[model samples]
Structures are given as C-alpha cells and as structure tokens.
Target: MNKRIFSIGLALMLGAAYSLTAFSQVKPETLVKQRQAAMILQGKYWGPLGGMAQGKVPYDATVVARNAGFLEALSKMPWDGFAPSTKDVKSAALPAVFTDTAKFKEAQDRLQSEVSKLVAVSKGGAEAAVKAQLVATGKTCGGCHETFREKQ
Candidate 1:
C-alpha cells in the first residue's frame, strides 16, 4: 500500500510540473492580442505627450501626470509573457523581437527605466525638468518601436 501511494504521488508531482512548463509558453494568438493592446495604450498616451514635450503642442502638466500613470502601469508588464518560439515570433508585432531577443530586452529595460524617470520628474515639482524627462522617455519609446513595432 505504501509503495503504491508513493508512486502515485510522484507521478502527480511530475504531471503538475509538466503542466506548468506548458503554461509558460504563450499562444501565438494571445501574444498578438497582448501586443496590440499594449501598442494601443502606449499610443494613446505617448503620442500626445511627445508632442507636448516637443513644444509642437501646449504642455499640460495634468495630461503629463495622467500619461505618466499609464506609463507606470505599462512598465510593470511582464516581459516573459512574450514567448520566444518561432510561431509566436511570426505573429508578433515586431517579428525581429524573436531574432534579436537581447536587443529587444535591452530596449524594454530602457523603456521601463525612462518611464520611472518620467514619473519622478513629473512629481519633482519642476516644469522644465518634467518636459525634459518626458522627451527623454519618448525617445526610448521611439527607439524600441523603431526596431520592434510594425509600421502602420
């Protein structure tokens, strides 16, 4: 009885582990949806903010603060959600993301870091500084998109 129970327990454990491993692989359709959602949100906020920072549009601290909040939320997204499989890459917003994983990761890190900096600048009580940081952050966004995003 003891031997049979132990064998069953071990099998269950191994099955659970395999299940987890399989779950870590994101489906191609799911990845495409996620990327599309991320891009839309990013565009909604970053495009106007970039214009404001560049002086092509009037700067509004309130808008900047609101957009900064969105960016903070976006920065927290798990990069691992993007699976590295060939099928996932084929459907990815930027197919090159698969071929240049290291560069993509670096760009993602830069984007997150710049977003944090932008948040700090927004709350630091300096208008000019906030604008400058916004520009810097916008550059990082553009840098990543230039390499990873499909031109639309």
Candidate 2:
C-alpha cells in the first residue's frame, strides 16, 4: 500500500511539472501572434494616412479619425516579448532596432506621441488641422521606419 501511494504521488507531481513547462512554452507563440496583429494594424493606419499626407488621397476627417484611433492603439501597445535584440533579431527586422536601443525607444515614443496628436486633431473636425496633424504623423512613421524597418 505504501509503495503504490508513493508511485501515484510521484506520477502526479511529474505530470503537473510537465504541464507547467508546456504552459510556459506557449507564451512566446502568443506574443508572436500579438506582435503580428500589431504590425497589421500599423500597416492599415500607415497606408491611408500616408496617402492623405502625400496628396494621393483627399484629406477626409472620417478616415483620419478611424486611422488615428488604430494608430493610438498600436502606439500604446507594449513592446513585450522577445524583441529581436542584437543577438537574435530576425533577418526581416532592420538591424538598427537591435543595435540602437535608445534610438529605437525614441522612435517608438515619437510614434505614440504623434498618434495621440492625430487623434486630438481628428476630434476637432477641421480639415486644415487634420491635414497638419496627418503630416506630422507621417513624419513620425517615416522616421521610425527609416531607422527600424527593413527595406523591402
């Protein structure tokens, strides 16, 4: 009876340990999924806003409002997960992001600030103000991409 009880207890403990290991391993994949979603949202905002700033598309307050909201959300997203540090950044991400942490953080902060400004201007429903904000936002996007995004 004692031997059987000990075997069962050990088996349960080992199973629980294995489960914990599996749970921990799953988190990195979840973070990668989150990062991918953020990238998509970033692209959506960048495309339309860039068009408006470049005069390729007419400045539309509704579009600005919509895109600004997305940008604001993306800007506020936490840079968690295994960010490609200098040691292990994917080939796709620009090397600078891993190599120049301070510059990268500055660019990220600028993006967030500009997006916040864009949201504010969009709320006012003034075309001129919206246009100006869009231009500023585009500059921030360009600056970050130039430094951090891989040239495709």
Candidate 3:
C-alpha cells in the first residue's frame, strides 16, 4: 500500500513538472503580458529620472545613470513581443499597430534613440543636457503611446 501511494505521488510530481515546463514557453498572451509588464517597470524607473530632469527631485549621478540605463534596456524589449501575429491577441495594443506598422515602428525606434541620448547625458552628468534629452525622450514616449497604444 505504501509503495502504491509513493508511486502516485511521484507521478503527480512529474506531471506537475512537465506542466510547468510547458507553461514556461512563450505564447501570444504571455508575450503581451511580458511586454506590458516591461512597460510598467519602465514607468517606475521613469518616475525618478523624470523627477530629476524636471527639478522636482535632486540630481544624483548614480540614480540618473542607473535609471537611464534601465530605460535603454527596456526600450528594446517591447519590439520582439510586438510580432505581427501578436498584434491581434487580447492586449491594449490597437489594431492600427498592425495596419500602420511603419509609422508605429518609427515611433518605437525614435524612443530608443532618445533613450540612448538620455543614457549618454546621464553618464556625462550634465544637468542641462540631461534635461533637454529627458524632454526629447518624453516626447518620443508620448508620440509612440499616442499613435500605437490604445486609449485605455
């Protein structure tokens, strides 16, 4: 009787392990959630950086460089998830994103470029340049969000 119970437990454990492995693979909804979560994290990082740039928070080189670097990294994450096919999935992404791919991609690329500039200025520790780059980066964010993302 004990052996039978042990066997059943082992089988159940193996089954659960297999299920976990299968769930780890990327799916359409998974990609959408991953990108959305990445964007949310980026927004968290943006708050401090924006505060510094807007003079609401004191300038700190370490904080600026770190957050700018994080934003630069995040700038590359959403593109892969925005696959032509994933556009139709249950996401806040608008259908226009698939139809107007070029314009949308251009906006995404522009944000990346601006984020790179922000990273460089942050490293240089130039207050004025960082402020200007922040404005540019914000514009890129607004432009892309307005054009590509849904109103919600």
Candidate 4:
C-alpha cells in the first residue's frame, strides 16, 4: 500500500474512534476538572518548549517533536469541557467563555492551527522555525485566556 494512503486511512479511523469516545455527560465540576487537567497537560508540553524557544534551555530535535506532538493532541481537548454550566463552576473559566461562544471558538481554532504549524516545523528539526511557531502558539493561548479565564 502507498504510505500516504495508509496514513490517511489511519487518521480517518482514529478520528472516528475519538469522536465516538469523546462525547459524554458529566457534572459541572467534572467538566471544570477535565478542562483544567487538559490545560495542565498542555502546560507540561509548552513549558519546556517555551524555555527552549526563549534560549533558557538547549534545543533537542527529538524532544521538540515529542512535545509538539503532545501539544497537537492537547489542542483538541479542553474545548469539549468548556460546557456552559462549567462557567460558574469552581473553575478559572470566565462566564464570557459561554457568552462569547464564537470568539472562544475562534481562539481555539487559532491555537489548533498554531500547534499544527509547530508540529510541522518540529518534524524538520529547524530550531529557528520551531521557536517562531512556539511564539505564535503562546500568543494564541494568551488571547484565549485573557478573554475566557479569570485572573488567578
């Protein structure tokens, strides 16, 4: 089989499986917890990568790819847990997250796009390119947080 064809097929199958397993009803607290946990996972990926991007840590191509992959996957999460009921729950999420749904969604899409760019550049082992993409990704995160998250 052609490698490209196989990869496309695998992606479609995985997407279908994920869509099936991702939907469920949970309490407001659970939704808040889930989003928080997902965000923490994102931080784990971003913290080290940000350090490397900012010259605080030495860059490694292998590690950058690994963390970029994690960020790509995590970018798909968290949004699902931003249920309207979760706004007033014990969370850092602001009520505007629900009230400004389209804006919130645009930020999520921007994050996803930036993370995908990071993953693409990380594959090529270009530190400069990856660093630039990392900066873009961080800005996207900040944009969403400023509007949707309460001050900590």
* Candidate 1 local lDDT, 44-116, one digit each (tens): 8888888888899898888888889898887656465466653344443577777888998999889888898
Model 3: lDDT of residue 45? 88
- Encode model 3's per-residue lDDT on 1-152: one tens digit a residue: 69999999999999999999865666878888888988898889888877876789897778878888999888888777777658769887888888998898899889899998888888875778788888788888878888778886
TM-score of 4: 0.81
TM for candidate 1 is 0.74
**Number of the top lDDT candidate:** 4
What lDDT, from 0 to 1, does candidate 2 have? 0.75
Candidate 2 residue lDDT tens string, 31-101? 55666677677887778888888889987778888888878888766355425522353434566766798
Clashing pairs in 4: none
In order, what lDDT does every prediction score?
Answer: 0.78, 0.75, 0.83, 0.86
Clashing pairs in 2: none
> Using alpha carbons, what is the TM-score of model 2?
0.72
- Using TM-score as the measure, the top candidate is 4
Residue 49 error, candidate 3, Å: 1.4
Runs with alpha carbons beyond 4 Å of true place in candidate 3: 1-25
60-124 per-residue lDDT for model 4 (tens digits): 88888999899899999999888876766777878788888999999999999999988888888
The parts of candidate 2 lying over 4 Å away from their true place are 1-33, 81-91
lDDT of 3 at 132: 81
